[model samples]
Target chain A: MASQAAIGFTRGAPSLDIIDTEGLVEATRLAFAEDPAGTTAYGTAVGYAPLRKWIAEQHGVPVEQVLVTNGSMQADAFLFEQLVSPGDAVIVEAPTYDRTLLNLRQRGAEVHPIALHEDGIDVDAVQALLESGVRPKLAHIIPNFQNPAGYTLSAPKRARLLALASQYGFTLFEDDPYFSIRFEGEQLPTMLSQDTSGSVVYASSFSKTVCPGIRVGYLVGPAEVIAGIAKIATTTYISPNMVSQSIVNQFCRSGRLDKSIDTVRAALRQRKDALVAALERELPKAEYTAPQGGYFMWVRLPGVSIDALADAAAEHGVAFVKGADFLLEGGDDSVRLAYSGLSAEEIDEGVTRLAAAVRSLDA
Target chain B: MASQAAIGFTRGAPSLDIIDTEGLVEATRLAFAEDPAGTTAYGTAVGYAPLRKWIAEQHGVPVEQVLVTNGSMQADAFLFEQLVSPGDAVIVEAPTYDRTLLNLRQRGAEVHPIALHEDGIDVDAVQALLESGVRPKLAHIIPNFQNPAGYTLSAPKRARLLALASQYGFTLFEDDPYFSIRFEGEQLPTMLSQDTSGSVVYASSFSKTVCPGIRVGYLVGPAEVIAGIAKIATTTYISPNMVSQSIVNQFCRSGRLDKSIDTVRAALRQRKDALVAALERELPKAEYTAPQGGYFMWVRLPGVSIDALADAAAEHGVAFVKGADFLLEGGDDSVRLAYSGLSAEEIDEGVTRLAAAVRSLDA
Candidate 1:
């Protein structure tokens, strides 16, 4: 097994071919040339002002509503630190991003998992939980092309979620990192865009679009919440990386970001298509959601053990994440395939290999 | 009061002239050219491997003992999250960096302030507190050019502090961001270097030497403790900014970092000298320690209230940090003058104006 090294289908990263190295270099150079002192000095706790202002302008919100962070994950940590108390109830998706669940657990929050369906999280289940008398501190949702599950929350569900938050007074943390990567569907309004009661804390990251290494993300919420988060940020980290933010500001201001996103979208669309086609042909019985924009495809192999399949897949030189890793409850029959990093050819071949592993598990 | 503008002498920042803008631009370009994919991809939670290796190699420690962070403050936050349980007894400098004190207080730690002297922290006070049956979970110390005090801990005191940590079974956190900026002192070994019982966690930042905008810092401690910190970092931030870390790696690897440090040292030394000379000439009654290096000079004005002096200083177009801001207890007669960001002429003039403010307060 060790001799036949596995081809990774588990990493959720943007394709290398789409990365605009020259554009990034140019932006970085311009940032240094224009404001070396400001770029290298201690920045404000919220973020670099130009970048924050630019993000605000893009979102059609005031600058005070947005706080730029190291990444969306930092925003999550800050919000959790600010909101969660021991034994406080919090709602999470059943097959959520494992790291978020881990963070909530570490904060001593009593996490209640809500099932996620094809359209999005089961809003009815959430409403039922709320009505049943669990007063949650927050409801964390990945609204678009959700990680692991690869299901975007429906527009109607987004509205219901917001209304529920407003009625129940629980904060709704909308984690929408992959919202802009839509390949074929009409873009839905963000939970935040529709939110008026100041109940939504919307977080998005440039990791999927610009570059993860730059480590830039932003959170838009109520001004007071943003201020509180900024205070926590002051103690946690003095500020975000100003060099990266400044370069990003330059890239964004130069209008290269949209072009870069187009490049990424085209490349990822091709890879996602290739993986979907391969999975249909190779593993006819496999059940999965076809994600519109994000990096993942969630496949459920009925009557097959995920642990056995994962081991067999590794032996066959194809690797993916077992769905159990993403869930707090049952996921013994599922797996998550990330097609973002691999080429179309690699995706096809990897799926074919994965099929062989499934057959081996059946044997 | 609003009409009286202030000339800021409160900022603890490096002079803009000393920042190597061209060198940083070159490094950033080189980073993109050399490793675009790695630089832009998801990095390990601890940090970029080469940067961590370089930091460890520089400190003469195993790489496992090092955990790279977003900044030194993030390192502080991670350590606090790991060690400080609610109501844990913790020892801090009397006049410590206010943010660290704030962070500890927020974590619900019962903080005991040990007095700081010209040579170092008052070790006798620390010993007395320990002997009085207060078991601190950690003792936080700024060993080199302590913030707002500009005092370096003596080598003998450093040894004693480590011994105390080992004897008391409490971790010693040596915060040493300004160690490399010393202009004229015999360099003392770090507490981590002297500790054999795995009782010291030494944190330092490249913010002062290379650039703060890159936001790179590291902690060298017991490998287990570092691993724990890395785990917390995994939750707080997936990783530090890899793009900045890569550029910094290029800067350090190319042998430009030492040169940059030299530039900062020369600039700060001249500014420090100018401020000292100005103080001697303009305010003969002001008592202060002439620091060998670092950004700040602590001054005590006998019979003058800091609040009144600060108000007068603003009216005279000179502003400094009132010492009350730094201390947990009394500092109403003191102030901290930061000379790092100003030119020599600016420092001289600023001090003269501050003297006028003192006289105004007297009148």
Candidate 2:
């Protein structure tokens, strides 16, 4: 049972070398030592209280406005389940996170995929849609280091989208799990921070920073909205796995989390550098955004209709998600490569294999 | 914000005293020491491989037939999502878990409430319903130590239910979370273990034995069906949290889990005895089946319409769920008291307060 060896760039997960295993184990020790009762019992649907409080403090929200979850994906699902009904109009970026699109479609929503430009989604297009009787109940956006596209939503676009949401009487679901992994660009204020009309429900995860194994994430919204979702959560999993969240709480409280984030940013920055350099060296004709931070970089080779790129690349011991996987339609020539889960050397090798596959397609 | 102190019998969670905290922490140390990568990475939807393998071995099934989840409620929800659609008929016990009814109703299922006898569900009623052309997509049953009722389905009833499912072409979802927590009666075989036909999807949780905070549960079925739910899980939360499950794996591997289960069984048996003795002493007119094992005792006071029982009990610093909360109709004379989350002393004190509240209602 020998498994095939491959350079995996398909999943946006952190490389093992970068994870602070000692710190997490230490945090677990601290969780049991300090809050054994909270960790070993079904605490509440609101999640580990200290973790929820910490998240609320980070977002400048009241404690009642925050609800920690199993992961940001679960947070997204809960929000969708709370707000979306079958046939309800919902807006998403054309090349959003594949799983997000999958969840929305599974819920039978009328998903209207709008174009995502370098500066973020075409905000004017959203305004136009809103004006033309496309009464979406929610607009989903990944504000910073957006998945698949690896483009941050510009501040102006963020404000414009928020304004449009307030104007159109629709909620803005801000899915920003990659908010803190930025290696370049100053941190932008969250839409939730700026919302005066209670239109934003923001979500983020500790997966990219702490580690994927922990699976702790949270949402910050209006008190009423959070409470309603908490009720749904009570019936869903009877409160999420609190043992991890309690450890996460201890991790955050111990000042190790900030250090871990710094460690991740520095390591991923090197990986990103190696990835872009290799892409330029190998595929000079390739098109991609120069991602400043986060795990992924989008690549498309111009004048190349290589619909079989993912398969061909896989044959060469390289793995990546095809761009079409993230779209309602279109993206056949594109692919998203996650660099976070690879060493700088591995990224170089993976991209070389990817370039070779592209050449084979051209042949 | 002065929160009222209450003796909680409302949640069927294990008391902190019974949980093997030292064993769990030791297991966590072992998890980090032995399989850091497995615990820290984004594991497959099948869950931590060794744990999955362990579960498969225990059930005498292939690893391909199992998919672990955040909890059994999640497993239930996934199965419901996969099988039941709006207006599809689903048969459940009349006094089932409240959250089960909540989830089914939310999915818009035309739920049929079957009568639950001391032995189990009335199979003849199900046959009559089937004769009347109610084509149920699924029949949900808790074969051993059921929630709220704490009654184990007899072997004959289990066999008959399996036969009925095979004949009617409906899936028998064996939700036996408390299968191992028994302190009395011989261990009966699971319906899944007995089924020759492909008609049972079984789920169980480690929450009862290990601790609720760990939140690891699983489903076992035919390979194709488990594969389908695994895909839904991939879209749902990427993967189940591997941290606790990995520790749970270590606990199992090290043979600590059996010892811990024994500890839990011994402690809960004492609590159960204390609860029953107090009930008989305080409420002589109370009607209750003497529970053999597990957490709850369903009590129906004859000629007593204390519909405000839960509120009155809460006023006296004792808490329990009203029986009507679990049923679609007619549980005005009943309540479910979970003794697992209380000490023997607390159970005695709580029952005393509950009897006082009942007397107030009678006055």
Candidate 3:
């Protein structure tokens, strides 16, 4: 077989320039030097205290409400395991995060996806679904610049979503990994901030901001919900790695997190601009959203078959995710390209190739 | 108000050391240096390829058979989630890992613990249980230096155990984190190596050997079992963090793994000796086994109530695990002391305090 090609525009990982490798190294070295025995020994279950405290302060949530997880992904899985049984009904936004969709599917939950408009998830559609006796056990949303769709829920939509959750008696899972890296637009309040009935379980991660390799993410919810997730976590990995936790805790405490996020936001913004410009100039006929913050752009290649476009792109040594991958129902003719990791120049070239691929595809 | 004592051992978690801060920093650095774009991006579900290759080589298993997990605890949890359901019967060694017990209990499985003897799990008991119409869906065992019990199945018993598994339709789960840390005795062959029925899901971890902070571990088994676990893992964490995996792969490949193990083993051996010596000098009436490897020493303190003993030890500023924590039945008088994390001097002091507590209970 010919050498397998491995290039893709379909990842949610952070960029290296934003990762603060030197800072992490220094922090780790300091952690070890400061306390080798502490680093090697056992740690707390909820998380390292300092890290938990820092996260609690950062998110404006109580430390008791937070539980550090292996990653935000684990946080999501743990919550679902506790909340959703096989065949349980879970709601989602159409073209949501693929992994979350897959997670619910794997759990044997019947997922109900509401249409996502350019502004965000259609609140009225969600209300209608809940009213139709769906009574979902959970609704998974990426309120801050969603994956694949790259659309942020407006402030009013956030409030309405939470209100609907309370009325319908379903839990709201707001996954906001890209909450801090917006390239433009006024920051919209998160579902957690707007939650009035304590129905929202908020998850965020250092992975998108600092490093994914550390596998340190956390969950914030009502104490009982946090406890339930903790039970799942206890059986799973027991706890996140304390060595990484402690060092990250130290880094955050030392005021490194702010600096790192600043550097990351600037780099991601430049790259996002490059990708957006390329999409506009080369594929001007295509419809897509430019995200205010976060890493991705969702392009609607109207009339073009996504499969044909993907195949054509692969031939040109470019690979991106098709809309079908993100949908609860497949066969959508859209594409998502992440412009975070690649440099501006590569972003232009990759999108140029993608534009060519879409143009070549049959309508 | 005097500070209320933390109601539980709320702060102690041995699982946190798997994250490896120094390794993570270096991994992050190298990840950026080698593939700057890849570090911040999403990784393959199969894990970082080098890490999988390293783990496979370390275990003498094929790469196809090994799947990296956040921790061995997660490996066990995922396996159970995939294989067993409510009311399913699972065979476990009596007085097993508490987390294993909890995982099974949470799943609402009927747990049947085969009583363990010094020679290891009572093969006769296991065989009898298998024959007794339990029809267990899974059999969870720690064939190499088991947790809590500190028993390694004798050579003959190993064969018998494998035979029983083959005869029974149950899948065997071999958790062997402590296999390589043997301070004395010839290393026994692993159950995975002896397994013939393709029924064994062999799990191991770097926590006991290196550190627990990074939450890195792996499982080797038939591809189907692994696939199922992968599905559970996918739902749980989307994917294990790539940063730590890359770092560990680099560390292992650099020949530092052996050196690290040597360093840890030396310290663990000294600590073990300290406890064994303390037991001989002070708690002379107690019955205990000299562990061949791993951190724990299982002691059955004579004529002292385990609860009283634990209470007294804690009062004296020494902490030990109560035996009841590790039992399905009949370990009310036993206790487990992990001396590895403490220094030789601390082990001496801690055991002495424990001995005094035991004496005072009788007084």
Model 3 stretches astray by more than 4 angstroms? A1-7, A15-18, A35-38, B1-41
Reference-based lDDT, each prediction? 0.90, 0.89, 0.77
Residue A310, candidate 3: C-alpha displacement in angstroms = 2.4
lDDT at residue A40 of model 3 (Cα atoms):
55
lDDT of 2 by residue, A189-303 (tens): 8899999999999999899989998889899998999999999898888889899999999899999999999999999899999988998899888888888788888888776
Predictions' DockQ, in order: 0.84, 0.80, 0.47
Index of the highest-TM-score prediction: 1
lDDT of 2 by residue, B96-203 (tens): 999999999999999999988888999999999999999999999988877779888999999999999999999999999898889987999999999999999999
Better of 1 and 3 by TM-score: 1
Q: Chain A alone, TM-score for each of the models?
A: 0.98, 0.97, 0.94
Please, what are the lDDT tens digits per residue for candidate 3 over residues A86-107? 9899888998888888888878
**Per-residue lDDT of B290 in model 1:** 84
Which TM-score does chain B of candidate 3 obtain? 0.91
Per residue, candidate 1 scores C-alpha lDDT tens digits across B161-271 of 888899999999999899999998788888877889999999998889988878898899989999988888887788889999999999999989999999999998898
lDDT of 1: 0.90
